[model samples]
Target: MSINLSSFTPYDLRAKLGEQLNEEVAQAIGYAYAKVTKAKSVCVGGDIRLSSESLKNALAIGLSQAGCRVIDLGLTGTEEMYFATVHYKLDGGIQVTASHNPKNYNGMKFVAKNATPIGRENGLEEIRVLAENILNNYQTSLTNQNLGPIEKHSCLEHYIKHLFTFIDLTKLRPMRLLMNAGNGAAGHVIDAIEQHFQNHDIPIDLIKINNHPDGNFPKGVPNPLLHDCREETSHAVIDHQCDLGIAWDGDFDRCFFFDSKGLFIEGYFIVGLLAEAFLSHDPKQTILHDPRLTWNTIDLVKEAGGKAFPSKTGHAFIKNDMRQRDAVYGGEMSAHHYFRDFFYCDSGMVPWLLVIELLSTKQQNLHNLLKGRIALFPNPGEINFIIEEKEKAIAEVENFFRDQDEKAINIEYFDGLNVEFKNWRFNLRCSNTEALVRLNIETRADPQLLEDKLTLLKCLLNKWIKK
Candidate 1:
């Protein structure tokens, strides 16, 4: 009997079929072979998950089956995969990762030559269809001709050297720094960085936490956005009297920062600061920013003689926009930073490096430098609401505040519902990857008003969810 695989959503497929494909390494190999049949080479990398190795094997088998040469970059992050794709000038690449999802889950991210992402508009949908067909058939050809050769390559040292080329460590000022890798794939790279500094005789105090790579995530999930997740890094910074603290997600492709005072630096402020930094070198350079938090970013970009372009939130959209505009830098409130020098790819490593350069060059403490800008947009951070009926809740919220003083408010529906009052604004967006809804509110300068609005929104959400 032929099953209707098309009926299953990506998440559903993950839940139902993720475990059945024990030999998925072969499937990935086959898919790569089938897609890049005419290509000269393909590069591969994976996140720090226990299942990743098995999946990589299955993928290698499938690639070999297609008769294409493969360069296996063992145990690396997504950005590293992109770097290998560009560095080798390979035909394409793939990274085995679910990206910040729980441990058991695993998936793949595909990229083309020059590290261009493959999305629905480009090639992801087609790839997904092909993968689905292979899953449905349940039969992979195990012929010798289908098997391709695998070559192991290590790029850790080369990647670190390449990263340093963009920012000169020699010019850096002495400061105490805290780094937390959350036991993902960032340890080796961080270690390499420390070695580089030590070897060069650079003067800086470094504090490390959970820097070892472990798939079990003994401390907690690698995500640093959650309040609970920031505890370890925050405590480390305070204990060490570090100038700054940085934490990365599971893949280490995105990094979050805290100042010396142990206060979480909002990603919005980083976006502006980085935009300003880039514009200093190239005036009026195009900068891409997500729409969630734009007022402050726009002001800073314009003040720095740079142009700010707003794009939908997501790596695919940001990358596409960055390429089209040749944006020098792009940032999202979620802490993802994209650099043009990094093949227009997002990297958790690059953000901290840039911040370090800025701190050293300006001879300013992290908090004092970012304090004024962060104060402009006092945000409640992001709050998630679990609702049975998402659409209904969204509509009710929209109707409740639509006409209640139009003169003092502005409303927009780009990605979700955004209501702007004279001094405060709030965004209500449904999670693209989950069933819950997220609300982010910020005031022009009032903390009390922000709290009140957040409370009212929660009450309305509770009312809608109960109904």
Candidate 2:
């Protein structure tokens, strides 16, 4: 079937999945990925979406036609593909997932050998072109090719075993945990992990809410990042008197957390906490963090006797940097946590394990673990504004702050405009994935200063929007 070809997108092709679009996109992606990597064997998997199975089959057919073997990992998370690709030493892998997107939306994430992401600059564009060509009937290069056979495989056991490599089983303390899978792909994985914990007598109580994997998404789209979507998990934590609350999106590539106090810990703080956790284990370890917000991560990394380096915010960039630096750990403020042992790929599952280990070893509550850090560096989190003239707005922010060179201290564009001033700093960057500007501001242990500066920046943003 020849699709419009223009309908598919870069990174992941996300759109309503009910129509024939899902299969078409999958086939195009499989063909494009196979052609690009020229892999002898490729692993493919999908999340709990209703269309995932059919889409995975269509993708496998395309892969087979491209003369590539397909190892089908039935009903798995995105990280499973990454794990299987590297563990099996396959040529390539593809995961059919839209991450945290809506129920109607579905997409795909592709990785080459060693679980390397295929982003825009690094082969994603080429894949996009090939997929478009195939969809539009211009791709006659590999038609009627000898098909490669499909084989079923399961990495659940191995993946669960590998997860324990980050923690000491003896140190795992008995504590109640509240988990909200949001009816996503994580339920089964969580079940497997809990089974292991129970078998090993790890002493952890797993209290589940919305644990069942339902494609209908009875609660919502499984995006815990949205404040409204987080209520169930928060309420469960308070009502159950759980020590920790963890939530995952569809496909489970990212994870969010809530303290026993029912307070949601922003992903920014988790990065710092995880950095500290990983660094304490390996003093002088190199840590990779996104440039969007840096103060907390840098401070924690330094305090832990490790080195901190900033990368442009995104998985591909962070993963590449992690591999290059051989960093012990890498984390984005957006809940994507990466590890050195995990093929430098991000996993929503690993962060919580490490955090649990941290909690057990330190014997501190989740809230206690974060309270001091939150107080030390008060931030208002990231604010996104829809402004068509993003470049103009960013330039305006830079110009507005340019006159204070003496007080500005330092200015850098590691990812976007990051202007540092005395006691307070803000990074105003235009989102690469959308037509919007994102602002993050932080001040030294002073909530008032943080709010005051945030208000000033909002004034600037509002002023520019009016123009």
Candidate 3:
């Protein structure tokens, strides 16, 4: 009965599998989840992590012990679990996934009925306390009266059908897509989609690499956001002369894109691209963007006749805002895109499908489609610093900018300290789990200004940041 409390984050659990998480801890959390939510039926699924299956099974046992029927989706992405929870009208659902963490790490993500998030503010704290107590002295429900049933179900077919609703297969031009799954859960969905494409006679060719779902992560963990991790997909894009290079994380909740030239497009640009795509036809739709990177998204969204608004970062916040405001789409600079059609949950699969559809509808390659937008708004992307005192560092940065031009700098506290100037802007935010602050800067077609400002910020914060 060993469990590390550090595994619990603001919204979900993510920690080293052996040291911080195991079968017993997962079970306790599962039982607590069932009891606290008073769920009569709970749906469970897992990613390809070596530990996720066992943890999911243990969680199922706990839910069943609490007299909840468990629908086990043998292996699926996080979005699929969200879909199932709402599609079946179940009381709650949980997906066992660490989501872009290292291979040795594993965790679980939770959603209440109708696929609403259950974050720390709402239910996680109660669940954590109850789980810890349960682990202190757990009981085996030998009595059938206390034990519920577990059954396996496949949500893949319906999930893919839902994905296709975003785009018309017949309209897609003949093109090759280099998809790098990075040996994670995404490979399964990619394979399934490929088969569907064949059956539908779609001419699109999927050039898949690192496509096997390996628990050991032979090609490395599935996070393409890292520059080092992006080489495989980028190079493949060039080598295969692909129309688009798409990459997904361990659990496939967020997706990254590369142009045909094998250059990785910053997530900021993709946000704008997607916002414009959605708004071009669906005019006046509300588009939500994170403050960390907003200039481009706001510009594109507004130009497309859509209303653009800012939402705090993270899935919990974005989903909640989307539901509240009835936003059609919400995107973060981190590549997580949420859709209203998908029960306001973020889906890695949906974004790319929409993007490919956009490419087809516009009759342009991915490079041509995004190059103008990238040039119009140049950015250094999000830069993270390993900081000791994150709040102090953020304050120093904010104050220094204000002091430099008190009349010129306008600051807004949305997700972070967003400081705006005449021609350039930046956001400084602290990481919730680590002593790190992320900085994002963008300039209006001023690469030199972007460089000069980035260099200045780097020099200003250098002393306070650790290597």
Per-model lDDT: 0.79, 0.86, 0.87
Cα lDDT tens digits for candidate 3, 146-228: 78989999888888888888887888878899998888888889999999999988898999998888888887788888889
Model 3 worst lDDT window (10 residues):
136-145
Task: Give me the displacement of residue 454 in model 3, in angstroms.
Answer: 0.6
For residues 68-91, could you state the per-residue lDDT of candidate 1 as single tens digits?
Answer: 688899999888998998988888
- Residue 128, candidate 3: Cα error in Å is 0.6
TM-score for candidate 1: 0.93
What C-alpha lDDT, on a 0 to 100 scale, does residue 418 get in candidate 2? 93
* Deviation in Å, model 3, residue 191 alpha carbon: 1.4
The most accurate candidate by TM-score is: 3
lDDT of 3 at 420: 89
**Cα shift from native, residue 364, model 1 (Å):** 1.1
Report the lDDT of model 1 for residue 18.
Answer: 47
Q: lDDT by residue for model 2 over 1-467, one digit each (tens)?
A: 55554434445566667443567767877888888778889999999888888999999988998989889999999999999998899998889887787777777788888999887777878777787777677834546578899999999999999998878889988899998999999998899999999899889999998888888888888988788988889999999999999999998999999999999999999999998887776888999988878899998898889999998787778888898899988988888999988889989999999889999989999898889989988887788898888999888888888865356888878788999977988888887656789998888999998888888899889766644
Model 2 alpha-carbon miss at residue 285, Å: 0.8
lDDT of 1 at 3: 32
